[model samples]
Target chain A: MKRLGYLLGKDMRLLKRTPTIVILLALYPALVAVLVGLAVGRPPTKPRVAIVNQVPENKRDIRIGGKKFDLDKLTKALYENVDGYNVKDPAAALEEVKSGDAVAAVIIPEDIVEQLESSSSQGTIEAIFDSTDPTRKAYVENTIKGLLVDTNNELTNRFTDVSLDYINIIVNGGEITFGGETRNIEGLANGADLIKDVLPYVPAQQRKDLQEFAALSEGAKQGANFAKSLLRRVGQPIKLQNKPVGTNSSLSSLAVAVAVAVSAMFVALLLGAGMLAYEQEDQMLTRLLRGLAPRSTIVIEKTLLAGICALIVGTVMVLAFGAFVDIRWERAFLWWPAIIVASISFGAAGVMVGAASGDVRAASLASFMIGLPLTAAALVPKGAVSDGLYSVLQVINSIFPFKPSLDFLRAGLSPGFDALWPGIHLAILILAYCLIASFAIKRRVA
Target chain B: MPVLEGRDLVKRYDERAALDHVSFVVEAGESVAIAGPNGAGKTTLLSMLAGVTTPDSGSVELPGGKLGWVPQKAAVYQKLTVRENLELFARLEKVDDVFGSATRMMDRIELAHRASDRAEDLSGGMRQRLSIGMGLIADPAVLLLDEPSAALDPLQRERLWELLGSLADSGIGIVFSTHSAGEVEGHADRVIILDGGKLLYDGAPADIGPGAHFELAFINFLRARRAHVNVGGDAE
Candidate 1:
């Protein structure tokens, strides 16, 4: 054990003296974590859109039942939600987008009002956006589509009100006979106010019927108001309430997992190939063997160094994630086990490679060849792939240490998260991998 | 008993014999130099004797005590300071008070002034000295070196011999393999010549005569041995 300490200390001193490689290795994962953290699930900035209104100038005046309406005024009201710069010609609007003056161009259809009035068919609004800023272009396109949606909603509401008004006019203009007394139903909307005043003068049966009628009228009026209000809000139903379990978003958690996995791999490989394999490459191990130290001592020292390096890199990645991403560390207990398990597992793997290959370059190359695919399997969004591919990926993911670690992190970082059973199972899985690797390494060294 | 001995040692690589039935013995306080041309099994024999690798069909007996091996290539960790390297080796050898031992070893190797310098920053002579110091850290009864002064200048080689002489006087057995017989002729008490994985000569260096170039002597010895083998094959 004392000899092992000396070996580890020697390696540490060597690493300290070679500050360039040490610093580079330390910063690699941290920088990657920050970059990935900042990028995940963040919405694109709003884009500037150039608008071209093509409805004829003379057709701007819209008349309905002798009431004059300005089409431009209505369009302008809906366009207020968009960051639109009005241009004279649709071609000119597209030219502005091409010139990088705007991210997108939206041209209102030429016969929009005519289509709406004649056939009730909505006219399409043509939009063009720069491909260079795809995210911003998509944002602008969605915004414009939303504006058109609002215009259609407003038109529908106006038609509904007009229909209601006509119904009200006809009902008021006619009369209904109740108990041989003809009463106008147009005032039914205010019947509750009228009934209280007339209750004393009416007979019991008549009074009861009037009270029922008044209640029915009041309910209908309320129901109509409710329908109108509901229609106004109908476009945006099912509001998404973002309830994050931890400080990190789902994307941020994924980023953390990937960063941790890669960093753990780097640390392990570096220790295995760079520090442990150096002895063999330089024939120092043979010397040590001839000396008092046994092969088991070499194994112990290599494992210890790899483990320490893995822990350092993993911790740096996690801390960088926490700093760049707003991850709630209060529930960190849930996720920390994955990091620990992954670090040890990778470290053990590194030692195995280092011991077996006895060449630093070979060990490093093998580590990367194995690690890259494992990381991808662990971190790639399972939903993005086909069901069949995802199933296959799940199987592949199960084969590597990264998958269980990533799974534990994802579940642990989710909202309303409980039941650490899955995490425990995954921890055991990683532990099994680490144990197997350690045994292999020990055997190889011996 | 001799401090170290090997009997009928055989080593093969890919069906080709590196060392064939090679045998030697070294007593305490003696220095033996294995002289050979390229591919003459000098390193393979040393490796087997050092117990770094096993021979195919024979045995090597090391002293019932510590042993040290220095490969042809200097194997000190370049990133570590001279003292740090010594300290690590000392600890591995279970030396108590590793720091004190390391400092003493550094002073003994005449590298005390550069104890803090990284091994890579040292000159060839200094690096070789440190390598030897690492080998001495185990306090081994016998030490094996493969071309220890291969990369050193003449002055450095002389200094190394002087150091080895003092160590020999202190009762340590040393076995070294070198391509240059000229360098080992006066320093080594016994000189063993090998050719084609077989020992051609084993005797004191003075037996070759005072004025003979050791290289020419070695070459002549190999040619005569090969001729004798060829003549015996024809008689058979």
Candidate 2:
């Protein structure tokens, strides 16, 4: 191993002479951290809007097609707890929608509340929703839709309960002559278990249509009490909270920044590889091997050197942006080993490149081939692609040293799957790097 | 006892051979000078002896721990100061009082004043002195140099010869290659001559001193042999 030790000692001595690595890994981060602390913005969030009520002033004695009805209850539901509901010009409500001042414009027409007291499908209402953003638009539509559906469904259920229809049928009647005989009659009960089973799978809005179909099927055997019980049991529509995981703005900004930072580390890896390639081109590698050192020592020293370099760079990046500016330091010193593996992986990658081609440009090209795919894996989230795709990426990244350990970085940023997984990532890196180093050393160079 | 020996050594390059079944040996206190035409495998043989490059098919047996090799052009770290280069070799070789030894050797070779200069900044002769100083730090049993005097001026060459004479006096085996047959005759204990990767003569410098005339005759004999006519009407 004298030869390897000699090579490593030479490399370290060379590194000390140049000191380019110190500037890049250490100084750059310190500068970036200072800039980020000074310039980045910080604040909280708030949401609001304006509501307009279009109910007529004479709605207490309102007219709808020469018919008058009371509208007090409807107006109260529309105006209660709302930020600001004004009974003013309809044009001003339209202006609110145009100027983006309001999320939506609600108009409660005259006699609309009166029509709600009876069973008829001929009533129309207008609630103009702004179409600027689909997310806000969907939010307004769903909220308004929920209220209207509940009110209409309540009124319909009340009407249907009073108008309950049924039929009586005699299954069998037999006349018997005896000392004392009584007329015998039997009643038939409807089978509705099938409808109940199928009803859950259909959409909530389509449940009313199914109700009519079931009613028709039971005309000859309708039972009022059982149907009433079914309605009471399945009456409440399922509610989904639909609220997104966290504050949308922060989540997105965090995601984008993490992706960029991860990709930037690849660039750092490329620079390290380029340094190795330079040594190869200069014939220093051969010179080192010819010295008094073993092959294993040479490989270990190189790996250690690269690992240290990567740790320094990764820590700097975290200190600059990951910790103070954007995301806090989630994994302490975990990334140190992880980055070391990544560095070795890249260094070995470059050795293969430089050794094969005996040139720096070819080495860079080889590194780029590796960097591009890992960059893609890091940029996208776990579920951003398909399950099959994510599985394939996991396999690819398992063999890759840098790509897998990034999961630890991801975990540090957003707590996830398990910490044990980073260990897997680290183990894979070490195993893969050792395998490559052994092959390179054991394999014939010429 | 002989300090370095190689038997039936052969080294090849690509499909061609640079050394063809060459063999030689060195005694413990002898200073041997190797002379060869360009491409005659002198450097290759020196490298094999120094354990820098292994031959295609050969064996080197040295009853010792280490050998010092001074390749052509010094091949030392140019960025390092003279003291640092010596210190590094001293550290690796486990030479006690390395700085003291380095300074002593540098003084012996007249490199004391330039000890602080970067190796690259030193003159060719000064660099050669620095390299020899490094080679001697471990008190190597065998020292192999390739073209040690090729780039030095006449005065530097004489100075190196004096140093070599002193080293040989101290019972170190020195094997160096050179193109100057006269220099070999004056400085070397034994002169070995190579022609087309073959060793033609190996003996005392005085013996080869007379063979300078034989070298001319040999060249003529070889030319005439190539120019001979055969019964088949083609030049042999």
Candidate 3:
């Protein structure tokens, strides 16, 4: 229809004439990305750990194949091996772990060499661990555990395959030594990593053994016990400003996405409200209604204008995301349609306000109503949100094309969302919005 | 046959009637002027005839002719230059290269030098003339002008009269509404008078009777009627 072309042409012309609008559209993505960067964002890093070497001063010299090593040497090796982490000492080290400074702790056995030569199971080599920080603790435990095992295997050949016997020694009436020589206190040590001395890496607190007092059934709750202990140590309401979800390399991206979705929908609502409101204010609507030019022309033109603006904005956002956030654009082909649908759908809603309000100023009330709630999607993650609120948001988002487009963009960015579904989302958004906009047009005429 | 015919047309706003059983017809190629004071419904009638508003009760019958309408305000895009406004209208009306026509129309109105200025920046009289130029852009069989002579200087007014005379000579049926008796006396072929939503006179220019002082006269009549309603007294 001539009306349709008229509207489309006018919108196209406006876009061509206005350079400011072009700039506004372009900055949308970057602005949102930067905003999200401010909230819950930080750089990538490894865990810091502290080691306490309890070996005697002489026995600290533990030997391996052609490698004479001491606790200090292994500590140095661990430091050199790991990246982005520092090995700190007892006095200054783990103030972070104790004051929640270090992620984990490592302690080496004193008679480590003696246990390796004894060939038997008289005494055990050991290490005490702080289970408070799993990230740091896991790394310390694995490295020490693997190294001791290798040392134990090498020690078996040193005795020429003799029937495995052991050594015992006494000190202060305590059976400090067992099975063999009154030997070097060093001979009773284990160069090996395992230690029944492998006390279950427990926190320094909660020393009450379950075997002594607590219900056997209570200790039976394996994972629950760990959780209860950890909760007590950490207290409630844990918070970290830059906790990065495994899926995102940075938390800032999420914030940026939320802002973009919120703003785009807002602009859409405003555009729609202006359609009829402007005419009514200027008495143009009355002139329009009486003219032979027909009412459909006005609606079509407004819708087209909104669509064009949406395209420009969406394209700019897509480009910015690619440049700064490392977004994959090849898969972004579907974003175009989604943006268009959202633009027109929101624009139509705006027009509805204009038509209903009778003037531009009156349309502001409707803009506020539609925009505020729709912005919630930008504020909270879908999964973290309560089920009831999420459902309500989903329904509200369905009311406009912008909602679906934003959803698709986010879904596309996140892992596990297939490209096909986002494309489908975009299609539905465009078709549904255009239909809704057409209905809005019809209402304006009526 | 009449170029435009309406029978007992009625338009109601909420509970009150704006045009109550109004009837009129204009012959082809005739320049008719609608005369009325404020609230006399002169605008309401012109708007209806322009096809911008529809009658609730009566129907209008037009026999195979085009209509061009001009509103009272400038109604031109302020951001656009004069030449731009014309081309926009021309394109909107689907006329071919309406550019040439717009150029000629501008020269006729003596606005050729000011053609490059935005419609908003123009003087009030220039803006009015530009609005007229827009109405005549399509050069339809029927030209509808609402308050055409409003806010025009003497020279501009004379120029507008000459333009209307030329349009009438071209056999374009021109219908204009005005509160000015000078327009009706000097130019119009006939005059139709409306008073308080009623047709008080519908005939030749000579048939206006003695009511050239219409706005003052109508206000007095309304005042007297108001007094009669308040205090039981004879009125009229």
Candidate 4:
């Protein structure tokens, strides 16, 4: 124990002398935290899309229920609804998309107004999107699709409203103007009543014909009433209400903090391995072994020193992330235990690697090769991988420190934190790694 | 009584024997030099005596059970000051008064003036002295060094030999390996020469070959051993 203290003191003095290493130890995690915080805290940038309007300017208006609706209004809505720019033709818009200046292009046909005016035809809007990058393509596609749906809904509602107005005028006996002539729709319905009243005085064949005409007129009015109700339903069939579950807005920041803390663990591992391997490569291990100190003392000292350095880095990273993002600083009591245990666990594993490798360069390389894959596996979501692969990852997470440490940190950030299981997991890992390190050191010195 | 003894130490690597049934003893206040050609098992012998390597079929006996080892290279921490390095080693050796012993060691190694300087900033000779001082911090009954002066200049080598002479005079046993025949004859009170894992000579330098120069005598001894092997005679 006394020798361990001495070894630790020597390491501290050496660390003080190497300013570059000390600075890097603190700076690396802090930088990672700040960058990740900014990335998650800020809103995403909108993707640019090109709009091609091919409709003729002279015939851009269509009359609906005596109200002039301009086709240019649709184009203006598209521009206001999306981050879009105007292009002259479909080819030019496509070229913009292909050149990476825009993510997608929307083309409105030249005869769109004519199609809207005709009851038998519908307007078609063509959309072209870049598909080289799948994620960007999905985003652009969703944005354009949403705009098209909104436009379709607006057109449907206007058509429904106008149709309902004409139906009311015809069904309830009113006058309407059409093609420079005013006609009383009530007079046409009153003719059926006149026919019915005169049916008894006419000849037998003529009276039968009059009775059929009067029934047909009454059926038309009832049909008009049914169509008006159907049109109202067609305008809006389903309504959606959005309600999010959690009130915590700092979830992204918490995730960034966890990621930065995990990175700090890796830094601790590399530092511990490199420092121990350097002792051997520099021939200091031989001299150290010649002293009365036990081999376990050296391993423990290295593990503790590495852990302390990494803890400092992790603390700095958490604080830096908090500056950029809202973090639950009150949960630091819970976070400290997790960070301390995880740092020491990884540090002990690093010392084991160093002892087995017995060379500084080899130890550092091995640390990265082993740590990166394990950390990646641990961090991968269960839904992202197949069942078999996720099962294997679960086993790795149970044995390694990365997953448990991440979980501990996430729990600390959460509203309700339970420290029992994660604490036990980290304790087991630390013990196992320290034992392995001790064995390796003894074998190396033997 | 002998301060250290090795009884027929034999160490092998796969098909080659690094140390073949080697045996020796060091008395207190004695300075012994192990002289040999390349791959002659000098380091293997010193390593076994220092307890750094275990012989496959032999035992090393040090009644006091305290040994100090200085490896081929200067093994002191380069980032630490000379005084810091000495004090650290003293503490690691579990000395009661770490600072006092470290100060004494600095003066003994003649590095007290540069005690505050980092080992990396020191001259090669100063670093070597610091290495030796680390070895002496424990005040062991026997000290073993492997090629301690291999990289030193002539003047540095002379000063190292002077330090070793004084240590021996202070009643500590020292065993060091070297390739220089002059070091074997001039500095060592006794010499042990090995070749091809076999001991060629073990006696006073003057007694190896009467009236022959020590270096020539050493060469002729090796030639005679090869000739005996060529004639299919026993080499033991």
Candidate 5:
């Protein structure tokens, strides 16, 4: 144990003397965290969309169910919803999208109003998007679709209001003109009732026919009232409301920050591997091995040194992310242990790599190659990959420290995070990696 | 009593033997020089004796099991000051009086004035001295160095030899590997020559050949060894 302290002290002095390494160890992870925070924390930028209106000015204003509607109103709503600019024709709008000047093009057909007026036809508004960039294309498509849905709801509401007014005229007994003679609907119903009252003096057969006529008059009035009520609800029947439970909306950003911070283990791995390789290059390992210091003590000291360096980097990254995003500073206690264990795990893995590699350059390249892909695989969402690939990633995440460390950090930062599995997972990984590193070091010395 | 002994040390890398059935012994208060061409197993032999490496089929006997090793290059921590390097090694070697041992080693290596200077700031000779001091801090019975003065100038080499000679005179057996015949002739009390994983000669440097020039004797010995190997191969 005393020897281990001496070795660690020597490494610390070495690290203190090398200013560039110390700076890189702290800055690399912090930069990654800051960049990721800015990406997910900031509001999304609006996509540029081209609007092509093919309708003539004269036919722009059309009547639907005796209510005047303007096609310009729909286009105006679209313009308000997106970063829109007018184009002369569909070809020009498509050209804008294809040339990358616009993310999408919305083409309003010349006969859109005619299609809306005709009950048998529906209007077709063409949308063109640059398919090469699927993510931007999907965003633009959804934005335009949302705008169209709102406009469709408004048009449906206006038509329903007009239809309801006509139903009201029938149900409330309004006056109507037939063959140049004006007659009240209530007066006709009363005349039928008068006939029914006279039925008691007539024969039984005549009474039956009068009863049927009275029934028909009441049924027509009741049906019109029901139709008016149903038409009023036709505009919108379902409303969606979101009720978030337990977790804050900003917690996702914190989770992202944690993931980015945990990735700093790569830096730790490089430091650990590079330190060992440097010892070998400088012939310090040979000297230490020749002394009374045991091989295991050397390995442990190097692993701890790497872990300590990584822990500093991880802490800095978290703080850097806190500058850009909402971080739960109160929950830092929960993540500190996780970061420490994870850094040690990566450090041990780095030692193993350094032991197996031939030199400093080989060790550095190996650390990057192993750390990058494993880190990415551990953090990639299940939905981002195929089921087979995701299953493979799940195995990797289960065994490696990256995903577990990220989960542990996220749990620390958010509310209602349960399950103590990640802690155990990281513990097991640290032990396994440390043992492997020791074995590799022993083999190298042999 | 012998401070270090090796019996039939044989180390093979696949089909090539780095050291084949080599054997040697170093007595106390003796300075022995191991002279060899490149790939002649000097480092391999030294490593085995220091316990840094294991031979395929040999046993190294050190009475106290305390040995010191200095690699071909000066292996001091460049970032650490001379005193710090000494103290660190002393602590690692489990010396009871760490501070006192370091101070004594600094003075013994004639680097006491530069105790606070980082090893990297020191000249090649000073760094080598520090490295040797680190090896000596444990008070080992035998010290093994692989070309300790390989990077030193004439003055530095002379100073290094003087320090090593004094250490040997103080009853610590010193064994060092070198390619310089001058070092073997002037500094070594005994010499061992190796070529092609075989021990060519082991005796006093003056008694190796009839000639006065040790370099000519060494070249001629190598030629004779090659001729003997060729004749043996023809016989096989």
Candidate 6:
């Protein structure tokens, strides 16, 4: 044990004496932290939308329910909430969208106030989108839809002929009114239940009008509820709530995790494969083997040195990520096992490559050939690769150690995360890598 | 007592034998030189003696202590300082005092002044001396060197011989291979000549017949061995 410790210390000393390797070990993780900070640090910029309001400047009022609502104020308010530029010419607005200066254009018809004032129909607003980028277009369209919907709802609530407090009563499961009679319907939970409670109290003459209005109102309420649900689904397909248990947000957590994994892999490969090959090149390996130290000692000491380097790189990456960006350290302790396992597994892989090649140049090429895909497997975001390719990568990744390490990291960062199963699985994978590496070292190099 | 012994060693590569039925012994304080042509299997013999590789069919006996091997290439860590390199080997050898061993080697090689210099920065002769110093750190019972002076200048080779003589005098068996018979003429206590992986002669350096240089003697030896092999084949 003491001999191994001294040998490991010597390896570390040799590494420290190597300037290029030392610089790479320190710089790679620092660069990763900065890159991650740059990539996902700030909130995404708002998309530009061109708004062409055709309502006359002189006539800015829409009369409804014996009250006049300011049309100009509503339009100004909507534009303020978005990166909306006002353009007079509709052609110019469309041209801006075509030129990529704006993602979409909102064209309000010239008689918007007249239409809003008309109790017969709702106003129509047309939105034209640039189809160059479908994802950007979808985001822009949803934003515009939301803004317009809110405007329409505000107008409906303010100046409608009927203030649907009565209709809202049924929707909200509060009270119902019909035939100048009101009844509390708090106990009822559904539309049908409310209708059943109210239908019996209506007089014969008012029955026909009340029944028709009730049925129409109930249907409108149901349609509105369905639309609200649909709008939510359209706005965001998945709602992942990053519970603030440790870091301020999930982006920071993901960035840190990826940085650690990437840096750990490189450090491992550099120390494991690079060092092994270096020993061979120096012809010092045979001399070392000719001594009292066993071949297993050499393998173990090299691996331990690489593992130490990996731990240093991993810790630095995580710390730098946390320092440069907002990350939760409350559960930072939970992530250590994953970080340590990642270092060891990746280091063992490097040892395997080095031992197998038995040449530094060959080991270097092999390390890169192996490290690149494995690092990608752990750190590449899902959508970054094509759907088909990503699925294949996922399958390939699952068969390796990095994926389990990443899984363990992700589970640690997640909210309400109380499971230790992934961590145990990762530990097992790391153990397997170590065992295989030891066996290979003993058989091939020993 | 014999510090090292190998008997009837036969190492074959495919159908060709690298070393065939070669037998030799080294006593506690003997300086043995293996003299041969380039492909005469001196290195193969040295490898077996050093226990670096196993012979196909031979028993090599060594009463265990540090058995040092200095390969033809000066294989020290180029990045590490001379002192650090020695310390590393000392640690590997499980030497109780790594610093003491390193210091002793540095002083003995007359490289104590450049102890802090990286091995890569050292000159060829100094690097070779460092390699030898690393071998001596463990105080080996027998040191096997494969063409140790092959890369050295005449002055460096002379200095290396003087060092090897001192090591042998201090009771460490020194077995080294050389291409030049002149290198072993006066320095070596015993000479073993090999031709075609077979031992042609083993005796004191002065007993190789009269008025003949080592190269000519080696040619004559190969001719006699080949004629003997042909005669045996015809008889068979």
Report, for every candidate in turn, its global Cα lDDT versus the true structure: 0.73, 0.61, 0.60, 0.81, 0.80, 0.75
Of the candidates numbered 2 and 3, which has the greater lDDT value?
A: 2
Candidate 3 chain B, run of 10 with poorest lDDT: B227-236
Candidate 2: segments with Cα more than 4 A from true spot: A1-13, A19-21, A28-291, A322-333, A347-399, A418-446, B10-20, B33-44, B55-57, B149-166, B177-236
lDDT of candidate 4 vs native? 0.81
Consecutive 10-residue window with the lowest summed lDDT within model 2 chain B: B227-236
Any runs in candidate 5 off by more than 4 Å, and if so which? A40-61, A70-80, A83-142, A156-257, A260-263, A319-333, A415-419, B10-17, B56-58, B153-155, B195-200, B209-212, B222-236
Tens-digit lDDT track for model 6 on A1-446? 87788778777778777788799888888888788877777776767889898877878787664457788777765676678889997998989888989888899888988887676987888888876787886887788877776576556456432344433454666655554586776421365556667888978788787777767766776875665455445534577986655434366776677777777877886678878777767767667655456666767677777888898888777777666676667766777767877777777778767877777889989888887877677667789989998988887787566767666676555554543766676566556655665565444422
Candidate 5 displacement at residue B228 in angstroms: 5.0
Worst 10 residues of 5 chain B by lDDT: B227-236
DockQ each: 0.39, 0.11, 0.25, 0.47, 0.55, 0.39
Looking at candidate 1 chain A, the ten consecutive residues that score lowest on lDDT are: A169-178
What are the clashing pairs of model 6?
A246-A328, A247-A328
Residue A149, model 6: Cα distance from true site in angstroms: 9.9
Question: A226, model 5: CA deviation in Å?
Answer: 14
* Candidate 5 displacement at residue B14 in angstroms: 5.0
Q: What TM-score does chain A reach in every model?
A: 0.66, 0.49, 0.48, 0.79, 0.79, 0.64
Output the number of the DockQ-best candidate: 5
True contacts kept of each: 0.77, 0.07, 0.23, 0.67, 0.81, 0.58
Per-residue lDDT for A10-56 in model 4, tens only? 88888888899878776778677877888877887766889888877
Model 6 lDDT per residue over B1-236, tens place:
68888899988888877788999888888988998766677888987776655688988888645578888889888888999889888877778898988999898888999999999999888999999898888888988888889899999888888888888888999888987767788678888877668887888877765547755665566566767763121100
Identify the CAPRI category of the predicted complex in candidate 3. acceptable
Q: Sorted on lDDT, highest at the top, how do the candidates line up?
A: 4, 5, 6, 1, 2, 3
| Order of candidate numbers by TM-score, starting with the best | 4, 5, 1, 6, 3, 2
Angstrom error at residue A318, model 1: 3.3
What CAPRI grade goes to candidate 1?
A: acceptable
Cα TM-score of candidate 4: 0.80
